[model samples]
Target: MRDAETVTFGGSALNRAAELRARPDEIAALLNDPAARAVPLWRGKPSIDGAGALGWVAANHPVLRDGEEPAIFLGSDETGPLFTIDLSAWQPETGADPVPASFFDATEQRHPGLPDGHRFAELRNIMADLSARDAECAATAKALIGWHRSHRFCSACGEESGVAQAGWQRVCGACGAVHFPRTDPVVIMLITRGNSALLGRSPGWPEGMYSCLAGFMEPGETMEAAVRREVMEETRVRVGAVRYLASQPWPYPSSLMLGAVGEALDETIILDPNELEAARWVSREDMARAFAGDHPEIRAPRRGAIAGFILRNWLADRLD
Candidate 1:
């Protein structure tokens, strides 16, 4: 977990410039500045040029028209500013098909103009391949765009909503309710007593693809408690002394994965049929085999996933 933030999309300690987002006038000024630039998103994939990913906000990207004027600004990162564009006032070019809600997948495609290795891939894949900054950009695009899509309607009064907080919040015109983006917290833990760790496979997962037992953090429950409860409920493995490990912001519709290591007090396997297809303990050596893709009966956890990361580290006795 020491190198957690080093992972792609693990967050690069970016300065989000919270104060700047609150000043509408300043944001407006930046949007209209001739020197400002844009980053076009086909869905959530960033536009790339042959010169590598074109520097956002300093080069050619998509432009958001604000009643004939450009109205977008840069989003800052740990390294510097990230280009963002507002599409509220723009229409599709003549004969050009608008990007579909699903076209976010297109950004991962290899394009001619993209800098070598600058193609869009799933965040999971990107985490394994790209730098932390690239992953952060991809995560930002996905989270912001997803918020835009889901908040077109106000949840409070079932009326329409408008963007606020520099795309971090939605304001409902009808009820005057403000809605902030949500990141659901989920706990993924490796439950162990002696040398064996508990793992489970969901019903629809690929055959033999087993990973750590996890569940969403319930309201009012501490993270450690959630890990204990989830493990007990799923595998009837009572847990004690839950230890926090690391976290990953899973932007598949916005989730923050809290990874942990739990000590199992009891080893009885009572699989909850509703929660998992199978649950059992695997020795540390067997886990190493799984990681190496040598286990004929099981597949290793998916790369770049929190589960895989945790399991790999656990196998090496590095989760301490």
Candidate 2:
């Protein structure tokens, strides 16, 4: 993918000053600095400004102070330091959807002090609208927030943990164990023949929508091997000569998608009964029609998603 960095959430220019994360004095000074800004997440929804862009506020905002733990060091740009705070329990204007207690809806909220006309919106609904910088900040915030929420206990000692390392680590008081945020690796491949690409639709995906075969990386598997194995398992295609192309940070709950292009040694469709509802080879012209929203039987993935970015770039002959 020639312009792979142009893919959404792939090309953030922030200098993540990791050295300063352990310097409490410096970080505290940053918190007090007038130019330091904070991005707030309320139940996974981001604070959007009146202009429909990612919104930032003074680090000293009251809601930021209300956060239970120290803010995560999101890094710094030429302007100043950037930070992320999770106020999921803060009094929002009713953010959670009416889904059962087991489900969550990030878009269901309104912030009182959001700039006029600003509202909290789900990342998926607004990812394509954000600048690359803003998208990086939001992804960072959502990922860390989700991890902290679910990993409140220590795995080693079965004890509660406390935030540490400027929110990059969790320290268990009982066992002195340390834990860090995790990024799950996923392989999404563009398996192609002369003029056709293999696509599959998972169960319950939107009608007519299909994307490249994808699966989680195993404990000791290589990226190239994962790509080949996933394609074979999902669609019974024998993929060879795999090459990595690009990557994207998909922060639904913290995932790094590794994009690859592979050669199909054999073209045979064998759908795993549990993995997909349908799998087929789509011709170039048909793929182009799907991109243009004119295909009667296929629809492309949404823009900003890794699958969509890979598919469109493949259609344009830019994956070389």
Candidate 3:
């Protein structure tokens, strides 16, 4: 994981301006500055122009609603003033009696003013051809917008909340509580024993698609422990001595994938059907074939995803 921060969006190291979020004056300064730009959100998706999808901000100044202000200024890249916009004032551009699209998926309703690519997909398949910078922008946009949608209610008081911290936090007027966007931690591991690795398929995955075994890290669990526990719980493969490999900020609603390479003490898989449709051991040779698209029955993981990155490195023997 030495080059972890070097990975795609992981590399940006944006300062995320946490301290500035709480100060109303600082937030106002950033918003009113001509250099400050707003990244548009349609439904929960980030608006993408061509260039790989991550960096574009909305051209218009966003109007704040309900006494809420911006929170969470995701620090600067080479771009100037990389601030997020919270449109609690958003109303569907649809017909009379328009409502917020956050209540449902709005990927199909293309806004006439926005770029065609400014939308969401379950997988960022479009990023396959985008430049590194665009991909980072796309990832940031998706993560922030999704955070806004899910945090409309205050966790502390269960009262309806409004955006603050630019677009990174929510505040409840009822009990004077504040909430911030959450990035759930998940552990994805390439479990290995000798020359083979473990991969599993979820019930609804595309035919022949298999990738690293992953599970969410529970509260108070260390990254290494989460790796071992998840591997054991899903495939009954006891793992020992987990080693951190790399990570990806999978912004499909905000998850930070903690990728690792784990030494499997035992290989016999007792798959919990509820967790996987099938679990199996694949030799390095077969994995290479899958990577090359030569395997008749299996497909390697999709590129730009953490699973694919892990598998590619494992094949290159770079995980060491």
Candidate 4:
């Protein structure tokens, strides 16, 4: 757990000046300040240069004209006031548009108003390559903006809501209801018995891909219980003691991944076809080979993901 925050999308200590969220006067001044820089996101993709750094534009950049709403303040870094603008309203050309419901979208869209090499790229493709601060800001931006896009109505009255609290919340004019951004809790655990770790592949995962068993936490369920229940439900593997490990902010929509380690009570494998396509216990030797690209049947875990981070630490006996 000592290296908990070292995971990708970990806290970067960005000063998220929450106090200014309530002050419209100060927010207006910051928007006009020359030092204000905005990170542009298009359809959930953050604009980045060819070199993997976030593509930051001046607050008044013309490309921001395509944004569906006003920029959401991220926080202050070394680069003065930082904000994120959602340009999902902009449409890409035919054929070059993103592939719908694909596992990974490799296409990049370049706006005519932005400089060369600045393209809105998928966050997963470059998440590991970005600096800590960039990753943190990008994750926050995507989650916050995505929330605004989906939760435009008040659940209390089914009426339209207006942006409030600098995009951190929405307020319904009809019912005086205030709703805040939401992050669902998910438990991704490394389950082990003896010298092997339990890994499973979902139905749509890439061929040969396997990862720690994970599922969303249900209401009134504890993290420990979630870990045990998920493992049992997916592979029918009974897990005993569960211990908290590291965590990562997984903003592919919005989720906080709670990483844990669980001791399997038995090594039997019974796949629940609905939850997993395959499940197996992999020995340390075989897992090391997979990580090194030498295993024929098992592919290495994706870099920058909590599963890989946890597995690598478990292999090196650094889970302390």
Please report how far candidate 2 places residue 132 from its true position, in Å: 1.3
Winner by TM-score: 4
Give lDDT tens digits, candidate 1, residues 1-320.
67665544677665667788778887666555566455544444454444443324443433333312222233664434455543333344454443345413323454334244533334443356645665666566666666677678888799988877666677898899999888899999988879999889988677888989989999999999999999888888889898898898877768889999988888889989999999888998888888788988789877778888888778777786
Q: 1-320 in candidate 2: lDDT tens per residue?
A: 67888888886888888899788899899988899999888777788887878878889887677777778889998878899887676665443442333223444466665556666777887888899899988998899988998899999999999998888899999999999999999999999998999999988777898988899999999999999889888888899899999999989788999999999998989899799999999999999999889999999787789888888888888897
Which one is best on lDDT?
4
TM-score, model 1 to reference = 0.80
Whole-model lDDT, candidate 2?
0.85
Candidate ranking under lDDT, highest first, comes to: 4, 2, 3, 1
Q: Put down candidate 3 lDDT per residue, 1-320, tens digits, no spaces.
A: 55565565564455556787677787677766667665554444454555544435533343322213443466555555665443434454555222333333323333444455543333355555556555565577668767777777778878898776666667799998977678899999999999999999998677999999999999999999999999888989999988888888888779999999989998899989999999999999999999999999789887777888878878887776
| Candidate 3, residue 294: lDDT | 98
Name the better of 2 and 4 by lDDT: 4
Computed on alpha carbons, the lDDT of every model, listed in order, comes to 0.69, 0.85, 0.70, 0.92
Q: 1-320 in candidate 4: lDDT tens per residue?
A: 99899899998999999999999788878988899999999989999986779998898898888887878988787778999999998888776698658888898999888878899998988898899999999999999999999999999999999998888889999999999999999999999998999999998889999999999999999999999999989988899999999889999899999999999989889899999999999999999999999999999888899999999999999999
Model 3 residue runs over 4 Å out of place are 55-72, 86-109, 115-123, 127-134
List clash counts for every candidate, in order: 5, 1, 14, 1
The worst-scoring run of ten residues by lDDT in candidate 4 lies at 91-100
Candidate 2 residue pairs in backbone clash: 95-108
Clashing pairs in 4: 1-320
Return whichever of 2 and 4 wins on TM-score.
4
